[model samples]
Target: MPNWLLPENIADVLPSEARKIEDLRRLILDNFRLHGYELVMPPMLEYLESLLAGAGQDTEGMTFKLVDQLSGRTLGVRADMTTQVARIDAHLLNRASLTRLCYAGSVLRTLPQGLHATREPFQIGAEIYGHAGLEADAEIQHLALTSLALAGITQVRLDLCHVGILRAIIAEDATAQKDEMALVKLLEAKDTPGLQVMSADYAPITREALLALPNLYGDITVLDRARQVLPALPAIASALDQLQALAEAAGPECVTIDLADLRGYHYESGAIFGAYVPGLPNALVRGGRYDHVGEAFGRSRPATGFSMDLRELARLMPGAQRKLAIRAPWSTEAGLKEKLQECIVALRKAGEIVIQNLPGHENDQDEFNCDRAVVLENGHWVIKNLD
Candidate 1:
């Protein structure tokens, strides 16, 4: 067996990549602050039950669980920050007014969401509690898009889906309610024959409505098609209206509707959406409205937000060049030492990285390209380009 080998899909992030992630993290948090979202840092672990409360139930398989040494109760490593933020809002903040929160941290998932995904995702997101209006959802969506744009991902296509539409249909049918998972798989797989067979004993309109879902995809006009083909249940109508209003708010050209795309239906209580670009294999950003995710915490307020894998985002962004390096000679001359110290302070204050040439090591040992050097030209210290 080899030492230093990481488990499958888990690898080290070296300095360059780490710096990019750090820069993007600061930019995102700065953006969040500008929008009135207060920063919150939840611990990486918690009791399993409270950790998986409400909307977090969907993350069960992906979470890593262990026995707590002190409490003896099982503890789980969070795979998502939304549920934790919900706890902070409902149980900790206990505020009646609207609350906006943002977080950035590493979460250990049991496995990647897809073939090329990472088991450890740097989850960065924001949450808004108390405002249930389309306005709050729009604000979150806009903030997410704005963050991606700040990271240089401008060619974005935003797809909108409402879990409420599908939830409404399922709640209307007793048999469907009894076997929701089976039907969800069928729909997700686009198994028309399976959906038809499963929906056979259902009411005629409801059966037809269930079948129409998988085909409800495309531009904003898909909403018009959905309204016409799906059963005119009041809940479905209201859900569609909300989806339309959000799309309009997001700009018609920037939005698309996918009624059958029930990706987060079970976990997401209301609207769910994903941000895409042409070359990326998965969404760069994901968010939605989960109105009662705080229910388990006892406050149960309306909430919405978005998160992005910061590594994925940093990969898509332009790489940053290593900053200036001012190499100083290793000398003990009292005057030379004092001058070198002064030079190091001045250069660093000017935002340049100063690398002192260490004893018995080449200046190149610092690994940064020796872009500049501190030289004593005619007994006074000065900086000159190495090249």
Candidate 2:
């Protein structure tokens, strides 16, 4: 293999794509700040236990683990940033009131999430801690939608799900609770036959509820159907009510429900959601409430957040145009050089992109589009339009 070859599903981002990604990152983070979210930069790697504090098997499987040389403890490359931010809130800050935190960084996964997905993703997101009410969930959902809009992804479909629904159903039957993981997989796949065979020994009501889940997906009206078809367990009712409130808050036009979609079933404590747009088979963003995550860090607080791969989201956006620049010639004459440098500095200070053309690279074509040039006309630097 060639020395320049990169690992599979990992490749370098060249100038154009990198520019788009960086610009989008700044835009989203700035919006987050405006919404009162403080930025936090967590390390890319940490002790395995701390990294997977309240995460489930999925996160564990995704995390890349290695033994630490100094502490001799196992360390993990973070596959997700939510848990790290949660730990910060629980131990580092320990604030009592509502705390909003946002982060943007690279995360490594042991395996690629999809056929064309990257093993290393530029993850960007925001989290709200200490607020357990449905209002916080609504705020997060709205924030996510607004962020997508800022990225020019306007035709979005917000599919909402609640982990509590399945938890409530499984709580009614010991057999189903024992086979929770298997049942969750079946539900996610919408495998009615598999669920039927596995849930045969479950209580009749549990089996019926489990079977009913696969069909309980569609617009907000699905909630009404779920209320009618599923058993009226108090927990189930509460989960449905919360889902309804959040869906209404998100607006009925683009909101939908999926009772069987249990993507974050193990990690999320309450409502979960995913935002999808055209041209992408997978969701562009995923988030929900994980109130129990902080408990593992010794400070349990209500928390909810959402994250998206900035690289992937950037691909969906229109390519960034080459920035207009002021091209200046390099000069070595004492007086002329100083004056030319001053002019270039002044232009740059005024937010203009200034590119100094090297002696030999007079006709070099590069990233910046230089439509204007700084020339030493009659002993003074002046700007002139390039022919």
Candidate 3:
């Protein structure tokens, strides 16, 4: 293999791992369906103008741009599913006043240093468009919780923040946006001194908020501290109230708020949230509201969506254990192979994994790796239990 031929961050998923990932995605999509969110497979490639219309800064840098041969127009591979859903909401489903859309597909983008460095990631997510209140936010949070529950994750931690709060504060100080972006990265890294450096030149109110950012973690009480520091903004206050209600709805055990969390695209204008399993360094799921994206696309609809990185969630799953092969030792005769295939189909229908016996390659070691064995001996069906 030539050294420069391979892409920098793409990795192949082998059969065993791919099977588990498919199963995981199925579980998540089923839960989405159960909640009345219909599945949608937006086109993997869309016109470059349409695709980039609503995507914020975080996604812009990652999009893989190209030109279409047939149409002779600029085109791009979707870097994320959220913007495509927004396009559908604004145009394809333009007649529908309210929509709930779900999707599962691979998004191509440059991976950050710590994100397992996989540029191609499988994303499963939902979007709720045309609603613009706390109820919408609550519903999004509920979807996140129930999806995790269906995945057999009993201990999920939520880190919630309001982009409105950060944006509101930053608007007062022009320097704050540049500073806060750097400060957010430092805070996410848990570096207090770095945060101080970022906020050093800001006014007292802004600097104090940045200094206090690290301590804005913990339970609902942290909201009280937020109120004390930046009390006047109604948008921030209403967002805080919304979080309180959402926490009550999510229950104390499954959710918690970390005001310091600043993940997601930069255009978020309302609440932003992330989901984490205990040991993972990054969030498995992320989302927020970006009302401006609609206007950016020449549509007036406000939208909010969340997407779970199926790759990261697949890793954190407790039962990511690989399934052993199931082998059959039936004779290679036409009649016997047909009967064996019938049995294998039945087992598969019952949600069991089965491996067909390879002709002319059967050995004792191959037979032992299977869950069970069925063999034809003396015209009788002989069953052997490997386990």
Across 1-387, the per-residue lDDT of candidate 3 in tens digits comes to: 887465877777765567668888898898888888888888888887777775644577788888899999988888888877776677677744777889999988855435455788888998888888877778888898788777677788887887776666666888887666676677666688887777778888877777776788898788888888773777778878877877777786667677777775366777878887776777777877777766665676667778887776666665455455567654567787777778778878987667666667754542224767776768655556776
Output the worst ten-in-a-row residue range by lDDT, candidate 3: 362-371
How accurate locally is residue 28 in candidate 2, as Cα lDDT from 0 to 100?
A: 96
Candidate 3 wrongly placed segments (more than 4 Å) = 2-6, 113-115, 170-211, 318-355, 363-371, 377-387
**What are the TM-scores, per candidate, against the unseen true structure?**
0.96, 0.98, 0.83
- Superposed on all Cα atoms, model 1 deviates from the true structure by an RMSD in Å of 1.6
Report the lDDT tens digits of candidate 2 across residue range 1-387.
899999999989988899999989999999999999999999988998888877634599999999999999999999999889988999999999999999999999879887599999999999999988888999999999999989988999999999998988989688888899999999999999999999899899999999999999999999999999999889999999999999889888899899888998888899999999998899989999999888888988899999999999988987788889888999999999999998988999999999898888865544688899998899999999998
Could you give the candidate ranking by TM-score, starting with the highest?
A: 2, 1, 3
For residues 219-264, could you state the per-residue lDDT of candidate 1 as single tens digits? 9999999989987889989999989888988889988887776777
Cα lDDT computed for each candidate against the true fold: 0.87, 0.91, 0.75
Off by over 4 Å in 1: 363-368
- Candidate 3: C-alpha lDDT: 0.75
TM-score of structure candidate 1: 0.96
State candidate 3's TM-score.
0.83
Residue 15, model 3, lDDT: 57
Count backbone clashes in candidate 3.
Answer: 0
